[model samples]
Target: MIMSTIFPEADVTEGLKSAMRLYASGVTVITAGQGAGRRGLTATAFTSVTMDPPTVLVCVNRNGQAHDAIVENGHFCVNVLCEEARDVAESFAGMTGKTGADQFEGFEWIETRVGAPAYAFAQAAVACKLTQTLETASHSIFIGEVCEAATNPDRTPLLHFNRGFHAIGALK
Candidate 1:
């Protein structure tokens, strides 16, 4: 087994990233804006915060193109990817070398009540209205109140771990 230790004076950024890669997480594409202004990005930093008001949070890099669109639109949709949507994930992640509206060219998207675009074939989609924003050094934590949601139960979620995409297998 391999382990890394962080010292007080050591830079922890790379270590932190390396450590996080071992943690498997569901993949998602967060989208915001409408029409010509639409933007989306592949992300895994999303979680449900509460059930009371159906709140959720997504962490987006402040420097990402979709970041400003999310803030200015005041809404975003978290589209949980299914295993079959790996191409969609790659496109939005800039792996296809497409940016902005181009990233959405080949996929069908539906607009939620809050005006954010949601992937039509996602495993699940949660539409949220931006309620709060907490800024960190390099990212903003977007806290949202879920306004609408949809799901495709037959599909299994896409997951990321060890720098690769994976699908669920039989239970241990």
Candidate 2:
């Protein structure tokens, strides 16, 4: 349920935003490399669209640096963060103030078919080529054709909720 009682008002958009924060989502580090080298950002708005055409979509804030980078490069890699990669997510989220090669640091990464940086230690990674871009008021939804994808069998996915990272616990 949406818990409507907490957001019952005509001008409660901010309140609804705050309430939406309670919904947990998997974290992803979306990256692209081009003349600007590599630019990426942590995101929680990625989803698979269709398996037939192997499509996936990610919503990026229109003002973010990576938003234009993805458009310029026409490709990107979705690095699904693992439970142990909270700092990685935070780093890509601009919390560290590091940019360019400095941000890559000790992470093992490689260029893929789409020329995007793929994380070697990601719980899951999907390389994609941009197919379409749909602009909404505050964000741009980028639909991509998945060119490659893989998942690590032993890792737990990282989650974001309530403006914080949550640990993944094993089910009993």
Candidate 3:
């Protein structure tokens, strides 16, 4: 015998957002472009997709200022924030009312091999060349092939959960 289930018609937008708030994720700043055209945004929707070819993906809202820059520049760097970089994350997230290149001020940055601006103090920086892009209802999924990577093993990653920042600790 087979069984079937019925679903409710309730809108899932708010529910989905609330649910995701409980999920802890490393914070990252996705940066692209160069010079005055540089753009960046704080994002948690990023993940590694494959290791063989070294690929990763990040979801950026279509309305974000960095979205078009990333597409046009054809490169981006995912700067994984260290626990001490909360201010940088806030600036990029628009909490500081900074826009465009202004958000990059007061911080040290390095131009990645692929030409994306990467935070100098990031725990890890993955520079990539844009390989593919998938557009969904409100965001674009950018798949990139890693071109260069740098890491600082001493730094602990910053995380986001329950609408706030957090740090990880060993369970033992």
What root-mean-square deviation over C-alphas does model 3 reach?
Answer: 4.4
TM-score of each: 0.92, 0.90, 0.91
Q: Which residue pairs does candidate 1 place in steric collision?
A: none
Tell me model 3's lDDT, rounded to 2 decimals.
0.92
Rank by lDDT, highest first. 1, 3, 2
Best by TM-score: 1
Best-to-worst ranking by TM-score: 1, 3, 2
Q: Roughly what TM-score does model 3 have, to 2 decimal places?
A: 0.91
Pairing residues by index, what is the TM-score of model 2?
0.90
In model 3, the worst 10-residue window by lDDT is: 2-11
Residues 1-172, model 2: lDDT tens digits: 7665665587599787886797788999999885347888999989999999999999999897788889988998999999888888988987888975466666788788998898898999999999999999999999999999988969988888888887776321
Worst 10 residues of 1 by lDDT: 2-11
132: Cα error in model 2, Å: 0.3
How well does candidate 3 score on lDDT at residue 106? 95
